[model samples]
Target: MDHIFRASRQWERIQNRYITEDAAVDLTNLKSDPRNFKLSLWDPTTNGVRYLKTLAYHLGMELSPAELARIRRTPNREIGDPTTVRCGGETLCMDYLQATYEVGFIEREIDLSGARILEIGAGYGRTCHMIMSNHDISGYCIVDLKNTLRLSKAYLRQVLDEPRFKLIDFIEVDSLQDDSLRSERFDLCINIHSMTEMSPETVRAYLDLINETCSAFYVKNPVGKYIDKSLDGYLQGQEAVEMALENGPLRQLLDIHDSQAVQAAVPAFIEGYRPGDAWDCVGDSRALPWSYLWQALYKNPRKPSDG
Candidate 1:
């Protein structure tokens, strides 16, 4: 499986900088320093219980008893001075919670049972694991940087069994150009918190691919100013989505604000900090600020150009 993975030039640069040959997939390594992904709160003392509770309340829902039990069983890491549960082993984390919320939102809006799904930028397969565990999907495709996909595949393989896991097809981001995959259609395509990190060309390329390969698509990204030094200079989430709507063969269906739990769980100073004009307090790192979570759905797919 490792031999099959290949990295694009864009991702190769990122891999050289952050990922190592002996990199182990674990909560500490993932949260501490990573090329493609970053964790907001890494303090050991920061407990996500209140944040999750508030998030569920604000979103007009609650975690079921089963979900709570599962969260408890997942592995956790204690980071700060007085260590607390910040990340769950395989089943619990901010990413896992957000994925669950997104799945619930989508479930209420559409019927995905037996639907063929394509997910771009599947981080560590948190969403993939959750979706497969909860839904009856016909097929699932994961598209991402080879390095990232390697970690995701390893992580998911540990959580999902042989039969259920076999439904997933791991495709490298660069492999999207293959005509066979490009021509294959999916019922839905999803991109979460990754587009903002992509260059304009890359974003447009993905939009074109999604339009060609999917009947509908969902995006969960920030709506305000964001900067990723590795890719585009400045990413205005709203502007990007609008560009896709205007240029691509898709129409906007639904748009909603991101969960407040993201802001609530972080320090108060970070909550008010704006990007460029402000500082990132959590990691004390220089990065873009996320003003709002923009979850949107677009429909009306089109065929790819023969040229």
Candidate 2:
């Protein structure tokens, strides 16, 4: 797999930086522990079904029978359960359901038939596989730490065909500033659950890159959790949005609170049917200020002269 999914040395530096200094637990260790890793655990059937239903309600789009069938067929790449959710005799993996929800949401907003997409923190390529398999994207780039991308590349290769796989390009974090990246432009940039974990400076850097490279962007992260003191201070969700509005070359189009999903998830979380640390309602802004999905759609700002 290493032979098939190669990484540049720059990826090594980024991986090291995250492991040694980042506030979150070492991703390498997290990747190894399937039981505790949030990505590894599968949501309950009830919660899973509710998530899909809620997303559909918000987007005003329903999943086709064929689309649901495809999701049921996609096996779980992570360790927990090959069949994460069993609904009406159909089995679906956690990643499959999540990817379906995310892709379905995006499809409602934009036609990704041949869009160029840049995804920061493509965990094991769950969403990547779903999007590539279902959509006719022209190009898809995954930018993340070396080890993380390695997992994604290997997992994706198992499910994606050669032609679809060929569309993928892996970019190391250290090379984010390269002329190649700066010159390139994308239809959309996506970051989910990653920016909230990063320092504000790191988040700002990525925002800068997204502004320079993409016409639109989507981010879904927690509202408030002061993970890094030096960079973000006490800011989280809305604060982050304010900062982006002030500095980034983009404006908000939508911001939806994720309370629906969070509310649906709380029951399973309380039952210990869900995985990872229990969803703590205390000390986390995501819960206190009404847990939000925050589907912020932003487009590049027009030049002052054009306006």
Candidate 3:
């Protein structure tokens, strides 16, 4: 039963920080915090922003001044108390801009019109909002840890109108069972960088769920391994544990898995796991360093063994 669906210590720290800052005017400006630079669209390096802008243009956003103005008009930039900067003649938050690019990533492969989608980690509902804005999807669901779930709820409530908001479901991660997931089948399931923060078992459980029902899925995560580090910035693994014993920070390794563990779940033998006609799946360059688009398939529903 997910064995409590344990999250790695690092993610626990991140969620706890969000919970702790639930009241504080949150830091959306990249320059506000050094730690924000990693693991979140809430912050992006200068080059990352540049790449995002370039991607957006390629996706056809900035082809004209009106298009740029339209992008600037999107609510993601300032909604939910995020700080934004001026870029390419538009005021933007890297988080919001990054979300736009992600929605575009999925749209090119699948038609989101009336799609019933599920997102594993909806960071403050950024991508959810972006998807709803760009498409006329029937519904959306977000399953995540408690802290992040709360954040998404608060943000989505304000951004999405009553009808659209009511169509959405927010489930806690632990509540999604193996045998019975949601009442209705989903069209697509998405998981961004959050899986890199999950324990391997947790990641597989989610994949198993998607395998059971979703028509398709999209994933963007770090390239290899789910090596967790402590909040104090000490890497956690067998090597880390050894360091702890040998006069290191005394932080022991946590139960985690290498990236290959996930690859095992989605075997290349399965057509659903295959890359698009011309898409380069090993896209460490676009998402982030050592990060890649692991898989985005018009899923075939069941694994080969299900036959």
Candidate 2's TM-score: 0.55
Candidate 2 least-lDDT 10 residues: 274-283
What tens digits encode model 3's per-residue C-alpha lDDT throughout 1-307? 4557787898778657643455235556534464454444444334555665555444443334543443554554566554445556566655665665566557566778878888889888878877776678888988999988998999888887887789899999777666657355887788776765665456557766776667667776533333344332453547764433333111122232434443443333223323233222322123422222343444443412110
Clashing pairs for predicted structure model 3, backbone only: 225-259
lDDT (0-100) at residue 193 of candidate 2?
67
Top model by lDDT, which number? 3
lDDT minimum window of 10 residues, candidate 1: 279-288
Top candidate, metric TM-score: 3
> lDDT score, residue 249, model 2?
20
Better of 2 and 3 by lDDT: 3
Candidate 3 — what's its lDDT? 0.59
In candidate 2, what are the lDDT values of residues 245-300, reduced to their tens digit? Answer: 44312222223344554545333222221111221211111221124433344455
Evaluate all candidate structures by whole-model CA lDDT and list the values in order: 0.57, 0.58, 0.59
TM-score, every prediction: 0.53, 0.55, 0.58
Instruction: Give me the runs in candidate 1 sitting further than 4 Å from their true place.
Output: 1-92, 178-180, 226-291, 301-307
